[model samples]
Target: MFVRIVKMSFHQDKIPVFLEHFHSVKEQIRNYPGNNFLEVYQDKSNPGIIFTYSVWNDETDLENYRHSDLFKEVWTFTKTLFNDKPEAWSVDKLVTLG
Candidate 1:
């Protein structure tokens, strides 16, 4: 499995808008081909900072999604709300404990 994490910092006033947009599209994103899971998180110390954690079948699957129209639509609106450039990481899971 492939894991992706993205960190974004938004203007304080835009947080609610972003959350509303996210809630509306999260299901579509999660159901996209090759996507295994999706989640969003907010920073404890900084409410404007958000993170998205997702699982993909592989890098190809992720790349495909990145190039898709859905991505373009989501990113277009999302980037407008950002206070800082987003950061992302793609990684392999080392281990998980139950």
Candidate 2:
């Protein structure tokens, strides 16, 4: 599987708004072909710092989603709330215990 991680920092006051938007669209994103899993995480001490973790069947699937209309609408709303440029990385699983 291909794992993708995107670290996003949002203005503190915008967390709720961001969460609302995410909730509105998460199901559609999760339904994309080759999508294995999807989730968002916030820093324990810094709630405004969030990370989006997702797993895909491969890079092609990941790219396909990125180019989809779903991404355009989602990202358009999402980018307006970003406090910083988000960071993203694609990686391969190295180990799984259990």
Model 1, residue 98: C-alpha shift (Å): 1.8
- The lDDT per prediction is 0.96, 0.94
Total clashing pairs for each candidate? 0, 0
**TM-scores vs. true structure, each candidate:** 0.98, 0.96
| lDDT tens per residue, model 2, 9-80 | 999999999999999999999999999999999999989899999999999999999999999999999989
Instruction: Give per-residue CA lDDT, model 1, range 1-98, as digits (tens).
Output: 99999999999999999999999999999999999999999999999999999999999999999999999999999999999999999999889899
User: In order, what is each prediction's RMSD in angstroms?
Assistant: 0.5, 0.7
Using lDDT as the measure, the top candidate is 1
